[model samples]
Target: MLNIVEGVRQYAKTDRLAVICGEESISYADVEKYSNILGNYLIDKFNSDIPTVIYGNKDVMILVAMIGSLKSGKAYVPIDTSSPAQRMKDIIETVQPEVIFNLSDKEIMLDSSVSKNVEILDKATLMNLMIEKSNTYDFEISREKWVDNDENSYILFTSGTTGKPKGVQISTYNLDSFSEWISPVLGIDGSEMVVLDQPSYSFDLSVSTLYPGIIFGATLFSIPNSLILDFKKLYAELKKSNIKVWVSTPSFANMCLNDETFSQELLPELETMLFIGEVLPVPVAKELLDRFPRIKIINGYGPTEATVGISQVSINREHINANKSLPVGIPMPNSVIKIVNDEMEEVPKGEKGEIVIVGPSVSKGYYKNPEITNKSFYVEGESIFKEKSPVSALDEKLRLRAYKTGDLGSIDDDGNIRFFGRKDFQIKLNGYRIEIEDIENNLRKINEISSAVVLPINKNGEVSHLKAIVVLKKGINESKLKKTVEIKRELSKLIPKYMIPRSFDFIDEMPLNTNGKIDRKKLYADIVEEA
Candidate 1:
């Protein structure tokens, strides 16, 4: 297996630029030097393998800290600057790191209220340490201090239904497996390529671009949250970025498409557009194809539990014109996806069931919570590979670890995986089981509707009704009341009367979270507050 740190080190010798955020750029040489200095500092300071918490956004130091932590045989937990103080407190309590690297320019005051006794390295202090250590200490460290492949590489905290976050521990071996599979699919050659990164460091989506890009010596061009919110500035930056590989959520892409200038002309170097974190709507796929005929629009499917993505398929004109839901694609090499029922029996090829993933990319399970980990992550009978072509001969002996994704999907007759939405998204209304995706998909088929999301409105403890939030197409001159009636009428023909949402809400744009997925939780909260 290839080591990620070694790969970056190989590129560092040539002085290739590794990361670019706004006007700031860092060469691979600097990245290696800074990270090594930090790693040595960490090893000397702590003398233990406790995970370090890196608090920042897209700052270059965040990556340095991540690499430093790994080099010191410790995992790093990345918390975005946008996160609340309370959220940071929760993670601090959970991990209880000896050191917290605050790489942001903002002063993050963590006293007894948040942390008891922990060293906080602010940006100014960290920079001084990096400079002092670089002049005084050697960058080379013994290989024995490097984290073992099976040891945790990073602990990513994800939102939990219980109001507390659950950390998913991904091992170095898991990341290496993910990089092995993703590197080829990303269309990167020996030549340098500029990769567009749109997600926060905290989000696993960044992993899809960061690790693979670094391994291939591709420069990562990141769009900070501020720039992303400003369309004029964002488009100007995109035009200048020369980004060849675009990685973001469908919602972010759709937001970019809102600008007429966001065509192939602006990003002529773009060769690939990767979508993850949510279902890619047909309209969004079609619009991109129409704008960039030569670009490969790839859709990937997986959760943070699986290192970035486990399955991916390049979208084509045929898939866009089919007027049907697009398939998520076949399982990547060294991974197996099974659609099974509640009894853990495999459902018929075309029948919908819970999507379970088993393979190397699976995480070590949630950190420090064995009860929850045992319930969600485990190994089944044996590893089964439906498609053998992509699997490497050497990977046959790899032990399979299974993760219950809680996502409803099925394998089609052609062996393509079709996503039906989340198992939790299925609502029981008046004794009829309804898939929220079904309602949303059918609603999107309406000519006037560009995007739709169906959310259940709960009364007391039970779902009382369904609410459909939609974004109308541009240049539609119809009145809101008239258009709502027409959409309801059109949607009724495709779905049962009971499946249609009782109320319709038209929004100018869908709210997307930091991960770039639809913010259903925020939407529901806003709706409740408005009521």
Candidate 2:
């Protein structure tokens, strides 16, 4: 985990460039000064044994403090400073950080449960404290690994859209394999500077923001918080920087493709667009291809449990036509993917089964819940044991417990895994059961669309109907756009008649939650109010 920091230590010996953001340009040497000061402070205060919560966006201080805390023998929990007060409070209370490094003074107003016992260090106070303390601390640079390989490096709280949030305990070993697998796929290199658009705390997308950029020593550029909502402003800011790689979710990329001002003229510097976090609609992929035909658009797929992405495939027009559902492609090197039946036996090719991934990137389990831990994690052959037969217990114990992915998929004869949809997201509507993702995927085949999301919404009549909210590509007309509803008409030929969305709502923007998922609850409320 300190590999990134140590790399900075090696190349950043002089005052060469390191990090750049709004109103801040710091040298490599300057970063180490702050990192060392913060490292010393953490070593003196926490002694590298307890967990500390680091709350902030992509600030230089947060990066420095993270390295310093880990090098000093403490794990850090990154809180999304942008999250709601209640959500942030819940995370702080759960983690119960012995010490916290935050960027704001208002965080002092956190729940009384946390505000009382937690040691708080705001950025201003922490920077002043670092300035006051002499940087003369011995640089023995303890080769000692402050965090064990399996120990929790960070406690990431899920988006919690399902219910109460669960903390995902990620280990140093998790990150190590993650970086190793993703680095080669992304084609990272020294000259390939990328922008950090997502906040550090958002789980899966963080790999795009942090790991690849640092591993290849590429420069990282950050956008101002105010411009995040404005496509025109964001495009202007992006064009101002010499960014070559743009890594973000398909939603953000679609927004760019749909905006009139966002063309090759503005984003000429961008060459690679790495998309993850959600499915990439085919139309959005085509729009990007239409503009930057030479640019490589990577569609990466994986759940957070698999450490960002285990499978990826480059998008092209021919590949999109070859299959209704885009193949997630082959697993990364040294990683194995197995499709097993309900009985835990390997299923035949082209049969849908639970996707069980085994690799170093898999997390240990959810924190503090052994019941869930045992259910999700267990020896593979334990269920097959015959006590009377006297099978070797040791052999069974060494068998790998395949992580039961909630996702359902199938592998073709060539071993290309195709994601069908989430097992839970499938629901019955009218006389038919449907996978909501399938309708969304079909709607994406339209040429004028940028993206689409489908969900069942309840009407005032107390009946649920399929409703699709669509975001269109640039220059699509409301009159002509409604004509593009023919895509759904075409979809009727493919899917069951009951699966079609009864009504289509065209919107300038889709509501997104803090974690970058479609805010279906909010979308439902908005449609009802409009009705």
Candidate 3:
């Protein structure tokens, strides 16, 4: 893996573009210089070593702040401006950041939920420090302060089975392991190339582009929320952005496919398209192949806890021609894919079981939630992962981190890995891993709701959107339309917009199984399957 901070500094020796968002762009020289300056400022301003929070949407400051935090040996948490105020508050409470960079145009108005001393540097203030305080270049940050080993590279707060979000801490060691594998696998030659980074910075999918883009000196062409909402501007921007390697969800690609101009002529330099964070439909893969005969379509699979993706397969014409399901391919050089049964024992070949990913890229675990972390992630020592020593036993830290993905899959005799559905109520919608109970818990919080159940609405073997069923308290007279509008309006405040249900059903009573658990299968049959 490329030593990201040092790698960028080495690349900064030359005059090259590092990031380009809409009309705005930042150079590698500036990225190195400014991030160093910010690092110094952070070290000086706050004596504490707590993580920093960056609040923005598709801005260059966010990138600088990220590297700056990395340089100062502090992990950074990126919060998208699209996040609801409550969610933002929840994250701030979790990290308790000493300083937060407000690169967005909007004001970050936090109530009593956050500490009053959390310093916020707006776009203007941050630029003033970076530009006006260039004389402080003499105060270079020493490599001793640079992040390494088990220290968190960055913390990503994802949806938890519990109502609140759980932050996944990816250590520097994990990032290094992932970078080493992803670089060679993708054949990134460390030259200047523009890569499309369309996902929101808050999303784990962004890491695929963010770190690699910086390491290889690729120009990250970011697509902001504004452009994503308007097709005309998006197409116009796509025509302008000479992105070579494409990185995004299948849904985003499918949206672009709606435009006839999205073809070889639109992005002639585009050669590779890496799809992660969601299931890539065969039809979508086939469409890209039909459009670009020479394009390399790589389908990757892993949870954010596994450092982006642990396995990838380059899709070819044969797979599409045969009308076969895409395989996620084999694990990386340092990782192994295993299928475990109910007893936590390895399953037989070709048999479906819960997929467990064991590798160096596996995250330490969920932050501030030890109970759930213990339930999901663990460490293992064996010949495959044991650190060899002529003297005696290997160091415990050298063992492999194994994550029970809670996802079901099977490995073929040829070492090919196929993904089945999830083992639990968690489902992937539009690339976000949503725990069904997370939404249900939030729904049950509604004053009028006595009981609530949420289930995924599947279409064409993909989770289209969430559909929720709720039973209001008796005598709460309200029309379905009025109640739904009111409920969604309330839900929007409690969770991210993507987690909110697109459709709702009012039920007379909550169905239960023999064990008195919510009969989700019955609700699915009545609400999603039957409908």
The pairs that clash in candidate 2 are: 48-73
Off-target runs (Cα >4 Å) in candidate 1 are 111-116, 383-398, 425-531
- Estimated TM-score for each candidate: 0.80, 0.74, 0.96
Order candidates by lDDT, high to low: 3, 1, 2
Instruction: Provide the clashing-pair count of each candidate structure.
Output: 0, 1, 0
Which is the leading candidate under TM-score? 3
| Winning candidate number (lDDT) | 3
Ranking by TM-score: 3, 1, 2
- After superposition, which runs of candidate 2 have C-alpha atoms over 4 Å from their true positions? 14-16, 136-140, 159-162, 379-401, 425-531
Candidate 1 TM-score to native = 0.80
Reference-based lDDT, residue 314, model 2: 79
Mark the 10 consecutive residues where model 1 has the least summed lDDT.
390-399
* Model 1, total clashes: 0
Superior candidate under TM-score, 1 versus 3: 3
